[model samples]
Target: MLIAQLTDTHIRRPGSLAYGVVDTAIFLEAAVAHLLALDPRPDAVIVTGDLTDFDDPQEHARFRQITAALPMPVFPIPGNHDSSAGLLAAFPEIAGRCAGGRVNYVVEDLPLRIVMLDSTVHGRPHGTLGAEGLDFLDRALGAAPGTPALVCAHHPPFLTGIRHMDVQNLFDAAALEAVLRRHPQVLAYTCGHVHRAVTTTFAGLAATIAPAPAHSVSLALDPAAPPTFHMEPPSLSLHRFAEGRLVTHRSFIGAFPGPFPFFGPDGRAIAG
Candidate 1:
């Protein structure tokens, strides 16, 4: 099974731009096209979060309109920039799967089970999976112990070196780790909100932060660096489940140079 991960879309209303600079909508459109063009298209798309610049109904609607192009299922969770109610309202189909107004649910039809969690803290930039969310995750993973599962959320449970973004990371990570440690079936913990692609290990499990299809958070390792973004090449994560392992690949968006041959027509190595 192949699952495409798209995060931090930050879509806005039709005429607006995110942060007065990025036309996130256009970026997402390109991303949609890129996904559609994939030779073996993803079986499903999991959007980690930040689906809108603002948690506005119109913004959510716009996000929906743009992603509706994908024929596969698109699962989303609430990020700091998004609200649970907003997401539920926009994608009512998922409403029945969630409870207590939190956008937490499971995708069971696929070979790799997906447990999407809500880490958004209302009106705040940071994230946390509180006791309730932790319990939900524990229960979800425990329900199917033999299934290989991937856990997803909006905020990363671990810190990235980017100071500003780190401050807003999932605060209750230790608690989250404790829960995940008990569930050996979890293959990885994936998230977004940092606006960059990052990989690390949490509780001995593969953890990744999917890059956005729009602007990327400036890569500043210094503790004093200010929060900023760059119009870097947008990208998405493709997770392929095979041979009892989950492998992730970063697929950049947009056109680039040609795929030139590495050898001559006679099958001889082409020397530079």
Candidate 2:
């Protein structure tokens, strides 16, 4: 299965840019167009979080303008910048009304179960998967024991070594790790929060964070260093699973200003 992961779009409403700088609406349009142009279209799209800059109702309305109709289903979870109520109010179909429209949800795509967890605490900059979210995850995993599942959220369960970002990571990863250990069927854990393409291992499973679709966080590991942004090409990740193994590829859209041949001199084309 080819699952496309898009995160940290930080899409801003028309005339409402972020930090008086980024034009998220324009970038988001480019990103969505890029995703739709993929050759072997992804079976589904999982948007990890930060769908909007300020989680405003108007922003959600603007988001709908860009994503209202796509070839594949788009699933989303709330980030620290999102409002659960506002998100549901916009994408009521995928938000799935459960426990009073909680953003945490689960979907079984046969042989693969996706557990979308909620980490937003409303008005908090950092994220955490608390008791209720953990319980929901436990039950979701228990539903299909033999299937290889992916636990997805907006916050990484472990530190990313960026000290300032680490301080705001999931507060109960240790507790969540205990639960994950019991469920060996889980293939990996994925998230997006630091606005960069990052990979690490957490709780014995591969963890991946996709790059943002607009900009990148500066490669600064020191806590005292001021945070910075770069025009580095924004990207997304595609996870392909077969034969019980998972491989992830990061694709930077609207990048690489070059023109190559669809077919090589040997009359064989390379697949991107």
Candidate 3:
């Protein structure tokens, strides 16, 4: 199964720009086109939060309008920039699957089970999977012990060395690790919010933070560096499950160079 992950879209009102700069809607449109053009299109798309710049109903409406072109199922969670109410209102179908007023649910129809968790805390930049959310995840993973699973949330559960972003990362990471450690079926834990592509390990499983299809958080490793973003090449994560393993690749957006041949027409190696 192949799954595409889009995160931190930060969509705003019809013509407003994010932070007075990025036209996030345009970026998202390009991303949609990129996904549609994939040779073997993804079976599903999991959006790991920040569907809007402000948790406004109009912003959410805009998000829905842009994503309507996608034929595959699109699953989304709430990020720090989003609210549970806002997300639920935008995607009413999700409301039936959610419980305890959180957008925590599992996708069971595919070979790779997906457990999407809501880590957003109202009026807060950081994230946490409260006791309720943790319990929900534990139950979800435990239900399918033999299935390879992928856990997704908005805030990355680990630090990324980007000081400003790190401060707003998942706050209850240790608790989350404890829950995940008990579930060996989990293939990996993926998230967004940092707006950069990052990989690491958590609870003995691969963990990733997908880059946004818009601006990227400036790669400032200094502890005193201020929070900033750059108009870097936007990208998204593609997770393919094959041969009992799940692999992720960063698929960058936009056009680049040509697909030049690596060898002559005679089928021999071409020397530089």
Candidate with the greatest lDDT versus the true structure: 3
Model 2 has an lDDT value of 0.83
- For every candidate in turn, the CA RMSD to the true structure comes to 1.0, 2.8, 1.0
Listed in order, each prediction's TM-score against the native is: 0.98, 0.93, 0.98
Can you tell me which runs of candidate 2 are displaced by over 4 Å? 255-272
Clashes counted in candidate 2 amount to 0
Indicate the residue-level lDDT of 203 in model 2.
89
Taking the tens digit of each residue's C-alpha lDDT, what string does model 2 give over 1-272? 78888888888868877877788888888888888888888888898888998888888888778976567888888888896777887787865545655688886754577898888878897887788888888888888898899889998888777877888888889988988988999989999988888998998999998888887878788878776777778788899878987788998888566677888778889666
lDDT score, residue 39, model 1?
82
Candidate 1 lDDT, 1-272, residue by residue in tens: 89999999999888888889998999999999999999899999999989998889999998899889999999998888889998999999989899999998999989999999999899999998899899999999999999999999998878799999888899999999999999998999999999999999998999999998999999999999888999999999999999779999999999989788999988999886
Let me know the TM-score candidate 1 reaches against the reference structure: 0.98
Superposed Cα deviation of residue 227, candidate 1 (Å):
0.9
Q: What would the per-residue lDDT of candidate 3 be over residues 114-159, giving only the tens digit for each residue?
A: 9999999998999999999999999998888999999999998888
- The C-alpha stretches of model 3 lying farther than 4 A from their native spots are none
